[model samples]
Target chain A: MTHKIDIKNLNLYYDEFHALKSVNMVVGEKNIIALIGPSGCGKSTLLRTINRMNDLIEGVRITGEVFLDGNNIYDPGMDLYELRKRVGMVFQRPNPFAKSVSENVAFGLRVAQFKNKKKIAEIVERSLRAAGLWDELKDKLNRPALDLPLYQQQRLCIARLLAVEPEVILMDEPCSALDPIATMKIEEMMVELKRNYNIIIVTHNMQQAARVSDLCGYMLLGEMIEFNKTSEIFTNPRDKRTQDYITGRFG
Target chain B: MMKLFSEKSIKKALTVIAFSAIAALLLIVVFIILEGLPFIFKVGISDFLFSSEWEPQMGRFGIFPMIIGSLVVTLGSMIVGIPLALSGAIFLSEFVPRWAMRIIKPTIELLAGIPSVVYGFIGVMVLAPLIRDYLGGPGLSILAASIILGIMILPTILSISIDSLKAVPQSYREGAFALGATHWQTIHMAVLPAAKSGIIAGIILGLGRAIGETMAVIMVTGNAVILPKSPLYSVRTLTANIALEMGYATGMHRQSLFATGVILLIIIMVLNYTATIAIRRRVGKK
Candidate 1:
């Protein structure tokens, strides 16, 4: 299977605090992968590495290569905006822009200077439809995005990412703020999304990983302890720590 | 029983203290209206407002020129100040490093603490001469006053705007960046729009400060009681008129000054009301 993303010996430090140790992993195209671990286990940190969001932080030092479609993203000449355009992210909380629903979905295209209003509207409608928000939000496109319910807002954020036509969607605990029903809705969308895009999610819920992801990687103390098929990781983790964490032992 | 008694008494005392401020404000408003309205009625409303004649000794009481002067100067100051103050705010809030901003922000705020008289002095000695040499007309003209008032209101506008910009959620910025927005695009699209109402509030406050400014305006506006033809023309604002004439005036002249105060009060209240409505509209949309 062709790899969508290749991380080679990735190490990240935030001002002498080692966040991600020497780590390597490859993500296949068109699958849902879940990274599960306790808090501060570098799961979210590793997820941010793909689009270089860590560069926004002060005093962050990274030494490794993250390649998307066989091109090293860490190269000095790489266009950061281009990299992020291809690799979109959804945050832990629903963070739609302080704008109308249509404008929120059209944010990416507007930034890219897409001047054709009709085409932009079409993409906005299509993206909202893909995220299953079109039927509910179509009439309320002019309403402020913050006024929406949490689940709808999260789906709106997903639609925002879809507007940019990203190949890889990085979700850092996208359903952490959501109730079980909302969480299930987001998980169902994730499952549906994997057919067209490589979806990498960092989540704390082990059961969510089991239910939605084809592949799962258990992380411990900035290291990838074990990664395999989700069923294998759940039923028979190769590492003792992974098994301990899976079976309700110490995190 | 002793603790409960003391608590009730303390609450009563605090309420009185808060009410005292309101009482003082109400008293002042009533006093200004009582003193000013009779004189306005005596002068006839249209002649008082529309006629440009302002000579007190001749009993000519028209304040049309001063009204125009105040609006023109305030408008000029806004033109000069808003862009500079807003850009400074955006730079401090978004682009500058924290350590650098810490130093720079306080230094700009220090501009506010410097006495307005000092700003006027600088205007007289430096800015006026430069304008006269290069831009023509009297050195102390509407243009000169506007520039000084612009600099004076900079800190007020800048600090409030920075606070508003900083108040924008970090998540909005992250959301924009996660979609491939450049730094400028994120700020322009997400942060600025979210902060619009607060920034507008800052500008309104600065407008109030500019309109009510007495000392620097009196010093540099040349105190000419006429409708200004250009920014280079010397003009007298309403505040300047009151300050320039309040001393040794009696009878109707004294009431006219009070009327000026009433007008100034009305302008400020209108500005504040507009700002509240603007901010409320934004909140209502949300």
Candidate 2:
């Protein structure tokens, strides 16, 4: 299968600290790929490279290539904002804008230049439905998004990403801020969402990577130690480190 | 040393400090009201508040002109000051590099440390002349005072606004960028809305600063007693009015100056109440 995103020898530095060290990875089409690593292992850093979100950080110097749909996103004079539009991201913490429910969902569309009010309203409703938040929020469409409970807020964030029609979604430990039940719901939503868009998730929870992902890449320090099918990585033979990590030996 | 003389003693000491601060504030307010209210009652509230005539020797004290002057000048200063302060705040909080911010923020705040008399001296030497030269009417007009006060209040508004903007989480910016928003769009749509109440507080605080200013205002605003028709016209504000007459006046004139204090106190109380509500709403949201 043609990969949705391909990264080759990706190296990133934040000032003097070497963040991601010559990372190489591939995410298959419409599939869920999880990056499992310890805290500060550069998994989230690798994920941010896909959408050039790292550019927002000061003193970040990146080398190597991240390709989205066979197009090198790190090419010189690239439209960074346009690249971001096609590859959406959800943060570890749910960060809905301090706006009404409908307004939060409609924010991406508005940024993308959708000015017709009726059209925006319809798309807002549809995206919320896809993220499984429509029915819960339909009645309180005008209530501030911050008023929602934590899980609902994350779901609303997902709905916001979906509104821009992104071909791929990057989630950085999306459920880390959520409870176990909320985590389960987000995992289920991810499984369902994979039918429409490619997903790359960086997670600290190995069990979550096992339970929700189709494939897994075990990362250590700043390197990807193993990349394979979830079952093979979790149940069978693999890199000694991946096996050790999954078996609860050491991160 | 026995747990710092026990937590109970510390608590009692703290309570005493807090109560003393409250007691001091109460004393000042009661003193002013007691000194001023008898004059207001003797003159009648309507004549005191609504009439514009003022001759302490003639027993005619209508400060309607000064009240209007204070409002007009304060509003003008905010109009001149807020947009610059707000834009500068946004640049500081969202765009400036860390190294630059370290230098720039302290420099902006230092503007507040300049003595009001120094600002007044500059207004006399530089600003008033420019206004008189260009805008007419002796240069020390409401326009001059507004510009001076506008500059005076910039640090207050800019610093407070920057604080509010900084309080907004980085996650909001990341979320906006992930949706492909340009920096300006993200700041306008996401960051600004989140910092709204704090910005309002900053503006209100700037307004309070402008309204209460005396020395700088007295120097720049020609201190005319007539009702001001335009920004170019010379006008005397409530604070300037009291400062101008309190030295020579006797009896009722002295108390009337205290009455002016009563009016200034009321205006400040209203502004302080509004600012507290805004600050509370901002904190409550988090």
TM-score of chain A of 1: 0.98
Which residue pairs does candidate 1 place in steric collision? Answer: none
Q: A1-251, model 1: which lDDT tens digit per residue? A: 44689888999999999999888888888989999999999999999999999989899999988989888999999999999999999999899988999999999999999999999999999999999999999999999998999999999999999999999999999998999998988888888898899999999999999999999999989999898999999998899999999999976
Query: Which tens-of-lDDT digit does each residue in B1-286 have in candidate 2?
Result: 8887788899999999999999999999999999998999999999999998988889988999999999999988988899889999999998888789889999999999999998888988999889888878888888888888999999999999999898899999999999999999999999999999999999998999999999999998889998987888999999999999988978999999999899999999999999999999998888
Best by lDDT: 1
Q: Candidate 2: TM-score?
A: 0.96
What TM-score describes the B chain of model 1? 0.96
At residue B171, what lDDT does model 1 achieve?
A: 90
Report how far residue A2 has shifted in candidate 2, in Å: 5.1
Candidate 2: tens digits of C-alpha lDDT, residues A145-227: 99899999999999999999899999999999999999999999999999999999999998899898898888888888888
Residue-wise C-alpha lDDT for candidate 1, range B1-286, written one tens digit per residue: 9999999999999999999999999999999999988888899989888899998888999999999989988998999999999999999999998899889989998999999999899988998899999999888999999999999999999998998898888899989999999999999999999999889988999999999998999888888998888898889999999988999888888999998888888999999998888778766755
Predict model 1's lDDT versus the native: 0.92
Q: In angstroms, how far off is A60's CA in candidate 1?
A: 0.7
